[model samples]
Target: MSRRPFLTLPNSHFFLASRAAAVVTTLAAALVAVSVSAPALAQNTPASSAAAVTGGAATYDTAGASAVQPDDTNNFDARQKDLDRRSTDNNYRYAVAEHDCYSKFFVNHCLDSARNEMREKRAVIRKEQLALDDEQRAARAQKRDEQAALQRAQDAADAPQRAANDARNAQAYQDKQRQHALDQAQRTAEAPQRAANEQAYQQKQRQHALDQAQQGIGASQAAANQKAYDQKQANFQQQLDAARQQGAQKAQQRVENQQHFEQKQATAAQHKADVEARQKQAAEKAREKQQQQLQEQQQQQQQIEQQKQQGK
Candidate 1:
């Protein structure tokens, strides 16, 4: 087929070519108008960019060539700022075009054309936004993966030391537990002997008190005997307290076990609370009894005071 020149074309072909040329010229003018008007929109850009942490910038498709060029990979922040500025300008321009459309004779058609151009530009911006989002997500995911790998390597390097520490702790815990158990068993086995000794000592003290009374001991001698009895009781209490100190160490040895138990005891928190409630009630009753005893003593003291006043 021989290609005909523009001027040598048939009349109908010429008209068609002229119409096509007019359409091309119109689109070119529209593009130029958009470019020029977009920048004329009012805006204020900040001094610093927020998206600089982005590792790589994603460039937009060729259809969005009119858009501001993307910054280098490390300067995604500026690219983002540029995109935002353009989007704002696009909206501003669209609003102005829409206002102008309302004054045209073909108002609906003008509005439609304006809307279509705005949407086209918006689509380009949206595509770039999607690309930028994807790149940001990828960068974040890569950093996360790198951190995870580093943590795993560090954990592996420390594994032997951790294992050795655990082994020594286990050995120490076992020794303490064994000693604690032995101490408890010894205390339990000696309990009967201790009680017997205490009872015999108390009986001897009582017999000595009875003997003093039979000998018609004066009030001063009785007071001395009472003081000696009180001293013995205190010494006995001190010995019991010494034994309790050993029990306290055993209790401490059981502390780790108690902690392990406590982890499981989360399930029994309600039961523990109920027990605490019952203990609180019991303590309240005990305090009430003590208060009653104190009141009784006060009443007795008042009666004695009244008797003395009467004697006076």
Candidate 2:
């Protein structure tokens, strides 16, 4: 209590005291808040958090829904159309490439020079196909003609036998009729004159029967002959038809074969031409390549000299 410094011990001590007081006050306020909210926080934590989370989830769901709302069907269709167009273009390109590589004679040589082994195989197959077609047609015509000639010969050989059998049958029938007429005449004759009359009738009947039989035989023979002639005529007609058909077929086949041969010849000629053209083109390309190489070598020498001069 004397007349000491009324301002306290020192400025530093005062400052430390004030800071400690501020820290204590802050800690006390935090403690008071915790004490006040402890029960309320326990009770409302679930409810409050649930409400907050639910609100946030709803907002997120709305954002997702909005994002998914735009239509993608049109975009998908457009993409599919683009794919189809690309596929079609690829197919067209492949077809054009195939035709360019395989269809023409010049292309054959181009392929050959490229060492495409498949092209040679295809050419061989084509030639074989043409040869087979020609041979098949020729064989068919030959077989048809041979068959027709065989049928005609068989018919001709069978004709006379049929006529002879018909004549025999006619003679047998006439003999039976003559015997019946002689028996009737004998029955009508009287007893005394019967012998002579019967004998005469029998003789006349025999003569008439023989004549009728002979006539019938002749007629039957003639008919058989006529039938044979008709058969012969039919056979002849068949032969003629066969001949005509064979001839026509042969002619047609010949024409087809000739055309095929001509086509093959043409193909060969075209192939030869293509080969020659390829050879000429290759020679020209070689010459051009040689000239280009020579020019490149000269340019390289000039460049080397230029470099050397620059170095100097």
TM-score of every model? Answer: 0.40, 0.29
lDDT of 2 by residue, 203-296 (tens): 7645854665566677777666667757866886798699769858865775686567558657756975896688579668756865764565
- Model 1 lDDT per residue over 1-312, tens place: 132232332447676567556655655676576566554332222111213212343344333444444355445676566676667666656766766654445656666777877876765565456455445545665776688579668868987986786677667767877987897799899999988998998899889889999999999989988998899889989988997897687687589676775564554566657866885796687568657645654664465457558646
- In model 2, the clashing pairs are none
Worst 10 residues of 2 by lDDT: 46-55
What would the TM-score be for candidate 1 when compared with the true structure?
A: 0.40
Say which candidate scores most in TM-score: 1
Model 1 stretches astray by more than 4 angstroms: 1-71, 74-77, 102-109, 177-312
TM-score of 2: 0.29
Please list the C-alpha lDDT of all candidates, in the order they appear. 0.63, 0.48
**Among all candidates shown, the one with the greatest lDDT:** 1
**True-structure Cα RMSD, model 2:** 40.0
